[model samples]
Target: MSKSTLKKGILQLLIANVLNMIFSIGTNFLLPKYLSVESYSQIKTYQLYITYVAVLHFGYNDGMYLKFGGRSINEVYNEEIQKNISTLKLFQFIMTICSVCVAFGLHDTALLMAAIAILPQNMIAYFKNFYQAIGEFKKYSRIMNMTTGLTFAINLFLIAVIRTDRYQVYLVGYIILSVILWFVLEYSLQRIKEFKPFAFDFSLRELYENVASGILLLLGNFSSQLLTGMNRWFVKGLMDTLAFAQYSFAVSMENFLNVAVTPISVTMYNYFCNHDENKDIIRIRELVIAFATVIVATAFPVKFILEIFLQKYLDSVTVIFLLFAAQIFYIIIKSIYVNLYKARKMQKKYFTKLCIIVIVGFAFNVICYAIYHVKESFALGSLLSAIVWFFLCLIDFKELRYSPRHYVYIFIETIVFLACGILLESIMGGILYITITIILSMLLLPDAMKKIWNTGKVMIIRMRKSKSR
Candidate 1:
């Protein structure tokens, strides 16, 4: 793809991600304050369970994206797409039913209801990914932003007008909106004829093949989730619901900061998958380094902003910082893996290393919590897991003739930037000082500034061209 096209793609991705961040931030800020700490924790837990459901449906969803998405709709026809969709829908339905039954059997009525309510949401997400893979950014962006806005508006109305103490009301509203959006999306796709439903001989052969690989992928993903989320679970166990509520807020802030990197990662994978030229590799590497630099530069100011806005919840700032660091590490590792997976269909080498890191992370978290406590153990586990994943990613990249020096440089820059921010925060005792330090640090990063300029110029050109067209 041309640079202009890539720039446009990134811009759309950025808009979608920004809308997502806004929706998430609005929810996090409003919901917890409206609901009691116990209710907030329950809401968060159910959300996590929903995430686990998504993971369980990973095979079909990923299969759809990889097989049907990478090609034109005509190239991969309605019969194939519909078959995969039906199979996936069936699989997801079965999983959902089984999960609901199990929850009921365990007498966990709250979780069962939450799972049932979130099923439509998950279905909408699958369709969203399909649209995304097909490059229908306009439709996808509209659905995402609108659904998010609707969710936020409903939550606010419930809290403000109805005075509903139950978070389930908000969840029900979310599910209803999701179902409406899904139907709209499906209708829109049908207008194109290519997306029309058609009967095909449904077979599990292809699905089984994909699932075999997906099983390993699923395990890897589950392990990563455990490593990332175990802390929150542990916090809930060790601390009170209020403490978990506080940590969740901080996590939401960190997630908002990292949202900017989402487009870079998505575009990186698509760019690498479609192009194999030597020149393209150079460009990819530059993009990766530039993206990483910008992310590192932006983290400090974003954190500063969060601390200011969430002054009432500043106690979790340190924990949030650690989580932010871990998230950045995750972005780097995932970016490289996206490229690796695209180039080579499937590899067990990185999978093995990921398994090892997960094992080490689990042990580290368990032992540290047993020895020290919740807060310190969580931080220490995140730091250690980052170190382990970093090295493992380095080893994997070397096998692909990729050097780790760029990542090393980015890591060092991040460390220095963070260290300077911490030092300034200690002495200055004001958010303004921290903000200035962050801005200065950003200015000091020449490569990051250049990338920003380049991206801006390309975007401006694209806008002018679109207007002329």
Candidate 2:
């Protein structure tokens, strides 16, 4: 890639993430204040249900990026790719009908309300993946930012206009916004005249072959979700809705923090897929270290911000700490796993490991719940599950060269930060001590600061040289 393209890609990523963060933070602030705890819990439960349904929408869209994205534009716009798109659309339609039927049959009002909005949501997601697969990062970033901002705007308007406490109204607004966004996306796709819609040309035999591979890939992705979100369901079953609500708040906050690294992760997958050689080893190492440092720095301050903003849910502090700690390991594994997926078509092996993670996670949840009460036990379950998944990923992708020493260092740093900050908060106060500690710790990272300064110097030198020429 040219330097201009690289810089533009980075800028697009920054803009997308910033917009997403704004919408997420806005929702976190507004939703809890507007909805009752039980109502918010209901919304969260429905979100979890829709998330599972989304997993079943096939994994070809994800596999498309790794498998086809590195190729030329003509190759990506091939007849086979078009056939896959048509088949995926048909499958999604069938799944939508099935999901609605199941939701209605079970009389799950919350899930049914969520299901009403899921079809359009999945359609937009598929189109976004298509954009990424073709390396149209600018377009993808624009659509994402616009959609996020629009969602927040719609929700805010509904809150003000409807002035109703009924959560179903919120669901209705969600469905309306999703439908409108889908049409806008469809129009946008049509405007790209090169992206012609092809007739369904693939036979069932061809699709079945690909579907088997897709299912394994889908299961691998689903297993990651299970490791991440299984705690919510376990906590809900073992404890009360209020506890689940608190846990959801903490998880949401952590996830919002992850918005910073998401662009890096997505770009890293594309980068490693295209360039897999020892020649890039030094560059990859620097990227990994930079990425890890960014995540750590962003996460530490955000935890304190969460405490300040959502003071009513202070009880979730322990759960939030554990979840954030788990995220460090999870992010490291994800960084390596992307490269592994790119290097080898080991979908079956990946799926097997995921299955193990799900089973182990379930067992941990059961054993913990049996031992202690729900809230505390669920937190332990999440921590243990993360540890197990990280090790399993390490063993499976042994070529990645991630070491126990690296993990040990990360764990020690995180513990020191948390322990000192917590102790000071207890002795002094929460807000003032946390703010001071965050500022001090951030300044201690000289290496990260040095990288930033050197990059700035290079950019300035380049600008001056261009002007002289």
Candidate 3:
């Protein structure tokens, strides 16, 4: 795809994510008001399981992503593309079977909803990743935006029309919405030239081969999730439901902010898959600047918005700020090294780095919790983990032409900047920290600022066009 097309796709996806967050904010506010703390905790916990299960399945989608996205294609008509789709269908069947077992065996309505939701969720991810693999991002963006819009509409109906606060009801609604979304994805795939109906032929050999190939990437993905979700699991295990309710609420708010990062990271992966040094430098610069600028720009607003809507959980705002500080490193890692590792098929390196991050994160978490004994420990542990991973991934910097001087600058900048916001621990403090970050970043990295300005300008134009439509 042309760079222009890539930028457009990223903008569209970013808009979709923002809209999804809007709907989520609705649920975030309404749910806490109506559902008891225990109920909210249960909802968050079960949904967390759904996320974990989806990652655990080790589906062939990641394998397909590598094969199609990383490999140079003479044309999209390669026979292996068909095989990849067939294997994915078989993988979906297995996930479906797991869902059936969970629904029947658990006898818990919330868990059943989460269990069944996995199939459609996987299907949605598979479809999106397929579009991503082919760099047909415009179509991908449209499909995802439709899915999110539809889900949002459903959520509004459930909240305003049905007026139900029951967790089971929401889960069932999610299941139905997920199924409908799968159909939408299927229809969109059918329009693509490379698309084919899944053959009734199920290959045990291919399924094993594809899944086995993706095992490390899957582990890396799972470990990444574990590092983020580890704190929640700890909170759940160590504290009561009410305590977890507070902690999970902050996590959810941080996740809401994370919507801003997804499209950029996905686009970065697609861009990195191109084996061109010039393009790689351009892509990396763009990715880094965009994330650094946007993260700082959104920091204070995130806290303000959450406090206005989720007053009951206002105490979690400080936790959100620390998590946002952690997000700076997290975004940098994913946008650069993680995508680099995947495009290069460096899954071993990727998995190793992830394991180290999680292990160190756990150690930090233990010490922080034992010493401080507060909700902030979880965010602190996560921050410490990302810091270590950033340094560990430095070995690969030679490939990117990054020097020791660059490393030192980034290290000191991050520490000082995050320390300012995290230590100040207020909305004004967050705003001031962001201001300092922006000024220092521009002075230290003028080229990166230029990249950010270029990206920001394009986003402004496209955003206007979107509204005009």
Best by TM-score: 3
Give candidate 3's total backbone clashes: 0
Superposing all C-alpha atoms, what RMSD in Å does each candidate have to the true structure? Answer: 3.9, 4.0, 3.6
Candidate 1, TM-score vs. the true structure? 0.84
Native-referenced Cα lDDT, model 2: 0.66
lDDT of 3 by residue, 128-224 (tens): 7877777766667766667656666766787789977776777777778878878776765556545565555566676777677888888898899
C-alpha TM-score for every candidate? 0.84, 0.85, 0.87
lDDT of 1 by residue, 231-341 (tens): 777776787777787777666666665557767655555555566565555445545554554454444554465556655556666666566656656776666664455
Report, for all candidates in order, the number of backbone clashes.
0, 0, 0
State residue 138's C-alpha deviation in candidate 3, in Å.
1.7
Q: Can you write out model 2's per-residue Cα lDDT over 370-457, one digit (the tens) per residue?
A: 8977575676687788778877876764555544545554556556545643454433333443454344334544344466678789
Worst 10 residues of 2 by lDDT: 424-433
Q: Give the C-alpha lDDT of model 3.
A: 0.71
Task: Give stretches of model 3 more than 4 Å off.
Answer: 1-5, 70-74, 78-83, 99-109, 194-199, 278-283, 286-290, 401-427, 454-469
Model 1: worst 10 consecutive residues (lDDT sum): 425-434
